[model samples]
Target: MNNMKNMKVPSGGAASTLAKLGIIGGIGLYAAANSLYNVEGGHRAIVFNRLVGVKDKVYPEGTHFVIPWFERPVIYDVRARPHLVESTSGSRDLQMVKNWTSSPYSSFAWPATYSLSDPWREL
Candidate 1:
């Protein structure tokens, strides 16, 4: 993933030197190199391709745990949401007060897989 573009220098001599030197700016350059020595020039930007390693996420506090890499991919989110509510009920002989809720929002962690095919089940 190398992208090299021809950059125009202010002078013909400078442009020729840069091309003769074969200077590539990292992994991102494009176009035919040394094609033009435009004194009145344009702008050029370089882009690079790279591989980034995944970060290891932390589990909940106060609990000892072991996470196997084979069992999980490292992209689960572990945020928490809360809900609270109040309610009431009554009968002929007695009365009761109740507090209840079903939270509309939730967050939890679940393991993901690198390979998703079922082998034994295929047969």
Candidate 2:
């Protein structure tokens, strides 16, 4: 009891250790959130860099990791997308052009997923 009473406890050690652990935990969480990206179902992801534009590779639906503060991911829906194309007729005749757009992934071939609307001459 006398030795215990005479002993001097070290102050601020536990508090400092807890503070360091809290800071490390916060940094880890931030890094994990920034480094991980989720590509949802029926969707695809493209990796984009801050220094460069869009990356060439397309990631499928899954969880992917990227370098924090260096690269980011852009998600696009690969499902059948709807787009309306408007064309003006040269003559005074009012004609309706019914164009059926196919899906990107289909029997009809396409070079890439991204493309411009082809001029439909057959009205």
User: Each prediction's Cα lDDT score?
Assistant: 0.34, 0.69
Q: What digit string (tens of lDDT, one per residue) describes model 2 on residues 1-123? A: 899989999888889999999999999999988999898987777776777656667788889999898887777765654444455444457665555554545433323444211111121
Residue pairs of candidate 2 with colliding backbone atoms: none
RMSD in order of candidates: 18.7, 10.2
For candidate 1, lDDT tens digit of each residue in 27-106? 12322332222211121111111232232333222322223221222222323335555677776779785758756353
Q: Candidate 2: misplaced stretches above 4 Å?
A: 1-12, 82-111, 114-123
Indicate which candidate wins on TM-score: 2
lDDT of 2 at 20: 93
Q: Which regions in candidate 1 have their CA more than 4 angstroms from the true location?
A: 1-23, 26-76, 83-87, 91-123
Model 1 scores worst on lDDT over the 10 consecutive residues at 40-49
- Clashes within 3 Å, all models in order: 6, 0
Pull out the clashing pairs in model 1: 3-28, 3-29, 3-30, 4-29, 4-30, 5-30
